[model samples]
Target: MGIVSTYLRAFNTNKLDPYPVEILKRVDKPTTVVLESEIPRLDERESGFNRAHRGDFGPHLTRERQRFVGKHPLSAALGNMQFTLAHVVDGIVAQEKAPLPNDPALMARHIKETAYFLRADIVAVSELPSYAVYSHSMATGEPVELNHKYAISIIVDQDWKTAEATVGNDWISNSMSFVAYSTSGFIACILADYIRRLGYPARAHHARNYQVVIPPILLKAGIGEMCRIGDIVLNPFLGPRFKAAVVTTDLPLAVDKPIDFGLQDFCSKCGKCARYCPTGSISFGEKVTRNGYEKWPNDMEKCTRGRVGNTKGSGCGVCVAVCSWNKPYTPFHRLVQWSMRNIPVARRFAVWGDDLLGYGQPKLKNKWWLDLEEVDGKLIVPTQAGQRGNHRRKQA
Candidate 1:
């Protein structure tokens, strides 16, 4: 068997580890009990990506789109799959306005089931908040407004084997990322197309190809809670290891409430991501209020510059690699997760134990793919691909 196959089998049949992991509490409505925020409506242009391109962050970050993951050959090919299928002038407007038995509940079930069938890790529905829509398009500099009332969030996990095998910001970094990006993008497009066939307006929002911001919509959908990694939402199950794509539509369906898994407190104490960040882009300081949102005040410019100009790799995910929450979905890890969630004292021990067990460091034997860098229409070996890797640490 391949390295990934072997790892999957091991992860699946963790019979030796007798710890139990349970499902998180699901609610009838969205609630933000822990995240205290005067979270104001943010313009689409205000995002770090747009800011970087528009020179708000700096001149260097302007190269983000042209260079970072998307611009690389492997990532570009994956993106092409998304771009080729992103828009459908005819398919989006179903040939016959066929209506299913106007049962929003059934529609919701069928939609979620369809996404699951398409390989989505998890699915949830929520009311897409107005503030979540971007004010303008980053690519065309044009106004983009989707009046879709509901958002169906589809999440896809970046395979654990890859994340475990390679240092987060190596040559294979973007490949690991694009696999999830393109897969989720394909699923979103299909779901949107399905919704359109139902005679309702639906649009697929994928990586950088979106008419709306995803974080708030995700929060509203009860998919995840915001973590210390600068407004990035982390799922109880997937943690920060997965990427999300949204299917925005006017489908009348049951909506989910925001979830509070006591992450705000956990993040306050465990800043492993911040400590492991190579560029010091992630903040170790306490969360601060910014633009009506109560979160960390990270240097978007620094983050963008680090990503765009990484001499060692196409992009970085070291933060995700080092995150204590990004573990396998096994009984043992699940118990650890529950402990971290329910027991405050366990949080500190979990962070320390994660390092002692060498969770963040790469398992070089599991490395399967070649470390080839796609540059200027040529694939070349990166000079210092995994040299700086991850640092060994005892505590946060």
Candidate 2:
């Protein structure tokens, strides 16, 4: 076998029964996905930021994203990390180059191994889809010009312990998102720089910055399946509790395929995220065709408002907190996960059991951060602390 094939064989050949087994159901190609062959490239300018910029959701989101995130110490720390890394996203290519094989498969394997070594939870590669690139930059309002041959997607899980304790949209909400966002962004930046040093054109697309829409590339790259929680992809291991960053490059590399861990069926039966969504944003009804792809229609306006206008916290993650797939990999959770993937009937039980066991409720005693909010211009003790505040559901 080639070096790449050997590496992938070992990677996909885990003895953990039905763990990688569940995830590595490789086929000649991705399951026939419903896609708009000529979908319009998304415009980041017209996104929720547009509404935020228009003073629709709230003023804080428009003036600076930090207004919401800087309310808490932990969230502020994570947000600051992004600020530090935001400047060097694109950098100089080194004149001296490292000797490496020209084989795409070998290169792909090496890149994946590199990302894993850098603490990326999951990584996938795919040919860059035309529709995946954003139509324009929200930063400069110019058409984003990117024609990379491959996309390297990196995913990072938000710390589950924090989510386990949080009431979803608590003081820790933006921190959870930023923690994953910053981590994945860090990985992507280094990976892209590495590729450029090898005499290739590479650009890191991250949380605070991007020239592409990630979910589409992620869907095509086999990292996860499309989720009902809007356009985000869901990894079987991390579910919706992760954020992603991508390195788009012209470096030749082998690619992965879209995954199918029975998320569509599970999401259909268990509309729990929609049921428990605080802003009535996620659709509890059937999926529909929008601009070509069949997906659950999300009210980004309501979702954005819920996140920006949260009285008790900086942002929302109720959907992530309550996803049936968002469980830790304990033996019990593993068995349940296997059953849900293999035994179709178990999906209903899994969904119902998540609530019966009171899995979505917060653990207030686990709260450890300060109860501060940035009001007007200064930080002060908020009247409603995230730990003591009310959520859509009570604790178990």
Candidate 3:
């Protein structure tokens, strides 16, 4: 067998090491989930944030969208940096192709290595699915006609220390998202530009500028499985605690298959995210087929309201903070994670143990950020803050 085939087989059989960083290298095909029907193309304008911006959710959410970034000073700063790089996602390509070996496997390996070198938490490549491309851009009301052959998916972890500290909907919420967004965008931009220098058509898709849907690309790239948090893909290691950026290109490269890692079974039984969601947006029922995929669907309007119209905090990440898979990578935790993946019988205990150990509760001792919000162009600590912890208690 070829090296890639051998590695994939080893991964499928669980022969490789189970380290967090090495998880991507071991994945082959999805163990449980399967795409039974063709997914329909979607417009970017139909997304939750865009719907909120257009006042579909309500006037409150539309107004909140305007101040969503600037409401938190740290988020404003980080968002500024991210927005600045959006302009460079696509640029001129070299006229002459570089003299390089025509090996897809080698190219894929090099690209993944470069992404890791750029500080990406995880990286994977997959064939770009046509349905994954948005029919129209949200920023500009023009058609998105990206025909890139491959997608290089880059994931960046939002600092676990910060995630562990707050109540997951406090002042630091948007900052955590922006940090990952900006870092992943930066890496994707550079990677796309590098590919263009080799005379290939390439484009970077990130938070500030995206022509493609992330969850499908993430799934096709073997990044993670669609968890119970609606459309969010959850890595066995990072859960839903990270953000993604994609580099689409005509550059030849090997593609990764979707992975399972027992996420569907685990997410079905563990409803901690649904239990802790401040607005109760996540569904606690069985997975339903939505737009061709079988998954739990969240209330988009409610989710948007909790995020954009949030008064007690900047933006919500309560689900990310409370997921059973979102654990620190200590040795013991890693062993438990492995069991959660391979041992189906252990999943129930794992779910129960997560709540028993208070894993999803806010770690006030780890709190590092100051609770500040920008209002009317002035920084102030609002008196309405700190109620999310109380809300969590009430829910418990």
Please list the residue runs of candidate 3 whose C-alpha ends up more than 4 Å from where it truly belongs after superposition. Answer: 1-37, 389-396
- What digit string (tens of lDDT, one per residue) describes model 1 on residues 1-396? 232442354456532211111234555533333332445545667776667667776666675555565545677677677677556412456666675768877778788878977888888889887778787776677877678789998889998888887788887777777888888888998888877877888888987478778888887787788888886889887789888889888879877667766788888877888877777778877777675566766777677777767887778888888788888877588567777766789888887898799888888899887667766767777677743444434243
Question: Could you tell me how far off, in angstroms, the CA of residue 179 lies in candidate 3 after the best superposition?
Answer: 0.3
Clashing pairs in 2: none
Candidate 1 segments exceeding 4 Å error: 1-22, 26-41, 54-65, 70-72, 89-92, 95-99, 386-396
Clashing pairs in 1: 29-257, 30-257, 30-258, 31-258, 38-292
Clashes of each: 5, 0, 0
Instruction: For residues 1-396, write the lDDT of model 2, one tens digit per residue.
Output: 232342343456443222352245555444435565747889988788566866766666666443766767778889899977787677777676668786888888789888988998888889998888999988788998898889998988898888788888777789899999999999999999988998788899987788899988888888777778877788777789889999999888998877767888888888778877888888877788786577788999888877777788878898888788888867577678767766799999998899899887887787777777776767788777443222344223
Clashing pairs in 3: none
Q: Which is the winner by lDDT between candidate 1 and candidate 3?
A: 3
Tell me model 2's lDDT, rounded to 2 decimals. Answer: 0.79
lDDT of 3 by residue, 194-216 (tens): 99999998999999999999988
Flag the better candidate by TM-score, 1 or 3: 3
Q: At residue 382, give the lDDT of candidate 2.
A: 76
The order of the candidates by TM-score, greatest first, is 3, 2, 1
Best by lDDT: 3
Model 1 lDDT, residue 345, Cα = 91
